[model samples]
Target: MTAPQPNTAATAKARLFGPGGLRDEYTQLATRGRQSDSESREWSGLSVGHRMAMLLLAGVDGDLADLATRDWRELPGPEREAIKSEVRAAKVAFSRLVSLSGRW
Candidate 1:
């Protein structure tokens, strides 16, 4: 008698950085002090490019945040290739990652 579960993509997004989730928690904290400052505040220790890589990975049904959580030890080749292809085709951009990551 198990309840139904959301698909992997939905569950992953909901868990990874959704509201009240860990990533959102830090992102919220970092942006809290930037209102009166001229310079934009930085996000959780993750670099913009690395963060971009995560979102790109997410978009393609890959688990980059998982990799990051695991410190990028080793991810599968096809998954990595798919993400790279998406980036190269200009189907998406790194800024999209930041934008989506901030979206909630």
Candidate 2:
């Protein structure tokens, strides 16, 4: 059976980036981590850094890292420009949402 998550994703994610009850969330994670033979004792805090670090440690950085470092000029001109434009638009859209309050 799946172990209980101390907080739901929405609540935990909110708590992580700001001040709330993420201490208890991480406490529960540590307990489950120990029970599952995972890292439990090394928790510092449940910040975005921790979340990103854990994602990177789990190899989530592989493809995205590769893509980020890729030379756009290596592709055919039309496709390269198209991709650059797409990425630029995506970046703009993402940035626009950064300052809004409450969930999307």
Candidate 3:
């Protein structure tokens, strides 16, 4: 059998940003936001907390695979809720931003 070939888009995305998965894309966006200041551009990016929330949303395949993962619960109730909201909102906002920017 031959070795598997990686999806170039996914590979490039993961290398420059994250773990190279759809869910991972959320986290990558956060990092990209930090590295750049363009609000319109960075909306797609996320903070570390945002990444964790998105991973959680993605279910079993989510990034928070390990039980040893940090205590998201320990955060203040408001903070936790806010992060969750941000993750959910991000899916819509990011896509709209990307579409409008036409940079893709």
Candidate 4:
């Protein structure tokens, strides 16, 4: 039998930016010493679409997942809210594309 295929998206992302590339953010989140399961999973989900967006934008730091952080809140409340809204909207759009891919 063929070996089970891996999550290639996650694998490719790891190669491009090392495993758990957001070490700094994760570290800060786990300042108490270790991360809980929920924190780890949350970071993984949040990074997916954000990573894809960075790849599409061809940002100079596109290959660096550690670039993500909670610093968005440092902005004024209105601007921070606007940025969060855009990110959520973009994530929804990307999910639609994922749902439509293949099966044609």
The number of the candidate with the highest TM-score is 4
User: How would you encode candidate 3's per-residue C-alpha lDDT over 1-104 as one tens digit per residue?
Assistant: 99989899877776654324454455548786343334323333545555555556534242353421434432335644655576568778787775687866
Question: How high is the CA lDDT of each candidate model?
Answer: 0.51, 0.45, 0.50, 0.51
For every model shown, the clashing-pair count is 0, 0, 4, 0
- Candidate 1 local lDDT, 1-104, one digit each (tens): 99887698878887765545666556558887332222112223557566566456546454545544432213345654654565466554655566566856
Lowest-lDDT window of 10 residues in candidate 2?
35-44
Cα RMSD to the true fold for all candidates: 14.9, 19.9, 15.0, 17.5
Off by over 4 Å in 2: 1-71, 99-104
Question: lDDT per residue, candidate 2, 11-104, as tens digits?
Answer: 7676764432565457558787342222222222334454344334333434443433333222235543454455456567768775574575
Candidate 2 overall lDDT versus native: 0.45
Q: Per-residue lDDT tens digits of candidate 4, residues 57-101?
A: 433233344435433322235544444466577788778785577
| Least well predicted 10-residue stretch by lDDT in candidate 1 | 35-44
- How far in Å is the alpha carbon of 41 misplaced in model 4? 11
